[model samples]
Target: MGHPKFPSKHYDTPSHPWQKVRIEQEAGLIHQYGLKNKREIWKANTKVREMRRQARKLTANSSDEQFQKEKNLLLAKLNRLGMLDENAGLEDVLRMTPESFLERRLQTQVYLQGLSSTVRQARQLIVHGHISIDGAVARVPGILVTRPQEKSISYSPASALNSDLHPVRPGIQETFEDEVEGKTQDNEKVKGESEDNAKTDAKTDSKKDKETETDKEEEKK
Candidate 1:
């Protein structure tokens, strides 16, 4: 309906944009998921809102046979998107959160599958066309990964990320190991320093005691 060059806004801005609690929650999600900005969170929230709205409409028309079919279809779609379980009902859809939608994104899935060290890196790889879905390059990090697509997600055959020697290939495991080793070495160094300081203090106290004993003996003489 509108100009194709400028797409309609997919998300609604909050009524109270400066609300403290909402801002804190959004900040946590942004950091936890390594999101580019709050717009990603808003997009997920919009998706959840739409799903719940559809569920409400279906429930209100429970008497219609067509409604039942549509409800089943909706459930299947949500289930495929990993937002609902196998036995999930309309209530599950109604209870869905923005986080559930965000978790289904290609970036999150790629990170979860151990293809990248962090969500940010996953997004980068995807946006750079290093990732693929069903053997086709998928550049959109925000793509909703369905159940079938989940299995098909992998580094693009032509991408350097597919190589074992690639920097990001080892992902979290190598970095985690290096972090643990570094921490252990740091602890050992701190312990060694503490022991050395204790020994120095004990020697200083012993020397002072000896000096005091010698001075008392001379005074008595």
Candidate 2:
């Protein structure tokens, strides 16, 4: 076993570091999911790669008894992570992408559940111990959340965010309709404010130009 202080790397770096397309894709994922770094993306990629490899193996040995056992195990694991349906098979596993893994992360679940306004906020809330699952604080933002655990995700009991009155907490909605209505109202309010400001600025600029023209005309006289 390795030293407890220095654990083995859980992820692999890209084989070709200078691949522009891969780099851009990873950057987009990182921004979308609020990942700490490319290492997180690499970790998800490695996990998906391993699952796909197993899927391919099971596909090749589909007629074997041992293959059935192993295939069931893999499918069960993926289902628990909410990455597959009850009737999904090896084909679905082979189709899995790093995004499938990323979507099951605790931070992503938190954001999807509306516990935070953004994925970045979800990560921050988790890291700061404001987020919880089944009433227990979960400090790891990237931990793979299970289907059952996803339902239990919420504010930690001790966290200030548990209080609905907390300033930092995003607006909570009881239904999808309410969430959409809230967002729509906020957008309209922001748009109205922006238009008002633009009109005020235009008026100020016009008055300044008039003043400049009057000053020039007076000097000529």
Cα-based lDDT for every prediction: 0.91, 0.92
Best by lDDT: 2
lDDT (C-alpha) at residue 4 in model 2: 100
Q: Which stretches of candidate 1 lie over 4 Å from their true place?
A: 171-221
Cα lDDT tens digits, model 1, 46-102, are: 888999999999999999999999999999999988889999999999989999988
- Choose the strongest candidate by TM-score: 1
Task: Report how far residue 185 has shifted in candidate 1, in Å.
Answer: 3.9
Candidate 1: RMSD to truth: 4.5
lDDT, candidate 1, equals 0.91
Instruction: Return the TM-score for candidate 2, rounded to 2 decimals.
Output: 0.77
lDDT by residue for model 2 over 65-162, one digit each (tens)? 99999999999999999999999989999889999999999999999998888899999999999988999999999899999998899899999887
Residue 155, candidate 1: how far off, in angstroms?
A: 0.8
The TM-score values for the models, in the order shown, are 0.79, 0.77
